[model samples]
Every structure is written in structure tokens, then in C-alpha cells.
Target: MIASRKQWRCKVNSCRHTFSVTSGTIFANHKLPIQTYLYAIALFVNAVKGISALQMARDLNIEYKSAYVLLHKIRKALLEQREFTTFSGEVDIDGTYIHPAPRKANKKIDRIDYRLKENQNPEKRCILVAREHYTAEEKAKNPLYRGAKSTQVVTFGETQSTVKHFADKFVERGTRINTDESHAYDVLYAILRFMHGKSQGRIP
Candidate 1:
């Protein structure tokens, strides 16, 4: 006799174990209906900028905890499982200071807060980005041809030590490094025998 949809029964003499559609799959032990899974997947796939767990919870009419777990499982499956290679060839690096969003206005207080001003705030965070430039031949064969092949994002102060540390960790020796006229990158000259190119203005 044939088994039901996604259901199976072992015919072995020692065991006649039964299992359902979710057996041995990521969807195993799921209480929600199959249609719910399909809908959730469609939402995730169709989202252009990506969706948050709270948004998914609202869309699926499910609890936040369930939506959070479901989203993580889906993300884990979609991520590429492999080792990352260090960046080589021409590399561009830059740093920028990111400020937190302004706090919401309070009806109780009418006075402006001077401490949160741009110049007065010492809580600004810095982000350093390294992008590897690709050649025409590399672009033609690469799946992601529109942008840099490898990128590293580091969160630290934009200082000489930070820049040198980032270069040592992500960039290969003897590789040409390109950046705007920033004194922080001066350390690269002493650390490695790299071809350093400094631009007069902002680099595209």
C-alpha cells in the first residue's frame, strides 16, 4: 500500500516506524499549517530590502517568538557555508562616523538638549570599510560584478592603529591600497611594502 502525502511507514521487520511530512526536515515538529510556511517563505523571498522578525510576526499573524525563530532558521539555511578568503589586489578603504538617531520629543519637556548636538556628542561610532577592486576578466566571471568582490566592515575609532590593524588582518601584503588623504593610513607604509595611492579629493 502507498503512504499518504509526505507520510511514510517503514516495512522493516524490526521496526514499523511512522513519520509525516516534516520528518528529518527543518519544518519538523512545526505546529503551524503547511500553508503558513509557504506564506512566510513568499514574504521573505519577495521582500526587496528584507523584513524584520517583528514585521514578519505582524504579517503572518503569529507570535513574535515564533516569527523570530522561523526567520533565523530560514536565514541560516540561505547563508553560504564556506570559508572566506582574504582580499587581494587593489583595495579601497574609508572610515565614517555614524551618529545615533535623535530621541523622540517628549511632551513633558519643552527645552532643547544641548548635549546631543553634533559637536558636543562624544558617543559617535566609527565604521571602517575595505573594498577590493576587480579587473575586467574577474568581473566577467564573477557572479557579483556590479560591486567589490570582498568587503570588510570594522567598528572602531578612525585612528592610525585601527587602520594599520585592519590592513594587516584583511589586506594581503604588496597589494596596492587606495584611499583619500587621511593621516591614519600613513602607518601602512611602515608596516608593509604596499603601493599606497593617495587621492587629492574624495574617491568614488
Candidate 2:
């Protein structure tokens, strides 16, 4: 069979790395030809009952272990493909806590425990998420940001600089940003307004 291998190149200007289809993948060490591996994975994903390595091996006439490994590899790629990038338009910013249980060891009898137990709580990092439809003007002005747009992840912290960085990266300068009256965002509106001044856009 004619093996057709996909190739990928690093886009970073500082680094140049050319790799085959199996690069940075679970299949990198497999001895099977690239074409066969791709076909097996496609069939496995399409299987109605959810294909197992043993089933794939029986169907594709390959080793059971190889089929299992390939399935896991595809699963990783599926996850990485679903990562969130940015947001636009009337965006909503909010934070939710994901508290991890506090850990404590056995205390010695009558020993003075002087550790900051409250500070040791694994504070869940903040999350910012938003989504909006793509407009004609936005697509024209920022072509790179245009697409069948979906959700976005926002930044954290109570500093203007942090908010400014998030605004620059996700929110276009002139778009209306809908957020609560958290003191952290007091200057966010003004900073975004300043950035919009340079572009003639208004905070909606």
C-alpha cells in the first residue's frame, strides 16, 4: 500500500521543526506503516459501539496492543483540538471557585500549630469565558480572529495591566464588555476605552 504521511512544521519564528504525521504522537514508535495506522484509527472512531483495541485488531488484522495504543492517541488529539482561545463583542466576565479540600497531617499532642491553614487552601484559579457572533466589520479588520467563532477563556487578577493584556488579546478595543462591578474591573473599562480611542471604537 502507498503510505501517505502528513507532515507538520513549527510556525514559531524562533524554532524550526519539521515532523511526520506521527510526530508528538502515541503512534510515533509504532512499526506499522502510516497509511494503515490512519485507516485503522478512522474506522475505530467511526465504530458504533466504540471500538476497542481488540476489536480493531480483529477487524484491521493488526496486533491488539497497537490498536489500543492508536485509540488513546486519537483521544488525545480530539481533546487538544477542542481548546478555547479568545472572545469578542458584548462579553461576560465572571469567576467561580473550585475549592480543593484542605490537607492536614496528624498533629502532635499540645504542639503549637502555627501554619497559615487558610492561605494553604488550593485557591482555584479564576476563569473568564465569553462568546459572540462574528460581524462583517470585525472580520474585515481582524481577519485572523474571524471564523465560525465559539467560546473563549478570559484572564485573571485584579491589576489593570492584567485586564489590559486580556482586553488586547481577546476583546477588541471598541466592543462593549459586560461585567460585574468587581473592583478589579473598575479600571478595565477605562483602559479598554483608552485602547478604543486609538481605533475610534466605543465601549458598548
Candidate 3:
């Protein structure tokens, strides 16, 4: 579904409250086309290396902070997408530590050794993306990444909220979910059961 059609809905089931995706987002009141935001995501994914928000805004024909908000939203959507898609069947997970790019020096200075120790890595991130050999093509159509299954983006946090949300929207209840030995999934039982209730009216 397109983001333009996003409806305000509460994250909690017990509440009948409704809210927009922007409710808790940085782009809440911004006046811009949802497509522009989508484009920002495309740029982030397609960028060979990191690109500044200013460059993104220039390329997308939008404001600099608009670009920043767009990037923020893209990351937000990525998190949601990753949360929804549970890794099942021969899942592969990994982590990476990215080093900060060297700042441009005002003037040439003597070279100084400033490297991290052997075990002390730079800023690290945990990625949680999944794959299913049978559902690869079908899942690729998901709006989040819209890329090939081999490169489906991963996410942070192990809460079942996202997995359950995905199941409620796509996967059928009782449809077994698979994952690595990450104990994070231990919380899925209740989430899965809760989602099953939400899926009843939608799934045939």
C-alpha cells in the first residue's frame, strides 16, 4: 500500500484511538508529497556510499531539512518493514561497525596514529533481515524495501510487535514462523496470538 493512504491508528489494540504514521514521527506536520519521502528512501538504498542530507535534498528537489526528515522517515519505514518481516528458513544475520569518515582538516598537519584497538571497533549496528526461499519473489513486492529478496534490509530490536504486525497484515496465523536461536523471539508467542485475533477479519 502507498504511504499516502496511511490511516491514523493506535498501536495498541485495546484502544480505539487513531493516529497518523507521522504522529510519533519527525515529519508529522511537514507539507510535502509522500512520493518525495519515498524517493528519499530510494536514494538511501541506492546510494553507493553515504550521502549528506543536503545532497539528498538537492537531488530530490526539496529543502535540506526536508531531506533530513525524509531520510528520518525512510529509516522509520525501514524499521517498521524489518519488524514486520520475521526471519524464517535458513536465516542469516550479521552486524557491522562503521567508522566515522575523516573530517576535512583546515590545514595540513603532522600525521598522527589514531586507530581503534583490536577488539575496540567503531560504532556498531545490529541488523535483523530474513529470507524464505519459497516466499522470496512474493515478499520482494513489500513496499518497505521493494528490492530483491537476497538484499532485503534488516532491522533493530527483537520485539514481536513488528513480527506480529506483519503477520496480521500478510502471513496467516498458524503459519509457522522461523528464526535463528535468538531468544528475542521468545516474546513472539503472545504477540503471535494477539495478531491472530487481528488477522481473523482479513484473512480468508
Per-prediction TM-score, please? 0.52, 0.39, 0.40
TM-score of 1: 0.52
Question: Higher TM-score: candidate 1 or 2?
Answer: 1
In terms of lDDT, which candidate is strongest?
A: 1
Q: Any residue pairs clashing in model 3, and if so which?
A: 8-19, 9-19
Candidate 3 TM-score versus the reference? 0.40
lDDT of 3 by residue, 1-67 (tens): 2356566555677985766666666556658876776676677988888678999989989879878
For 58-104, candidate 1 gives per-residue lDDT tens digits of 99999999889998878766654423466777777878876744564
Off by over 4 Å in 2: 1-88, 99-118, 133-160, 190-204
Error of 2 at 79 (Å): 8.2
Query: Model 2, residue 19: what's the lDDT?
Result: 75
lDDT of 2 at 24: 67
Query: What is the lDDT, from 0 to 100, of the residue 18 in candidate 3?
Result: 60
| Model 1 CA deviation exceeding 4 Å by range | 1-50, 59-61, 70-82, 95-127, 140-144, 180-183, 189-204
Query: Scored by CA lDDT, what does every candidate get?
Result: 0.73, 0.60, 0.53
Clashes of each: 0, 1, 2
The candidate, 1 or 3, that scores higher on TM-score is 1
lDDT of 1: 0.73
Error of 3 at 8 (Å): 13
CA lDDT, candidate 2, residue 137: 78
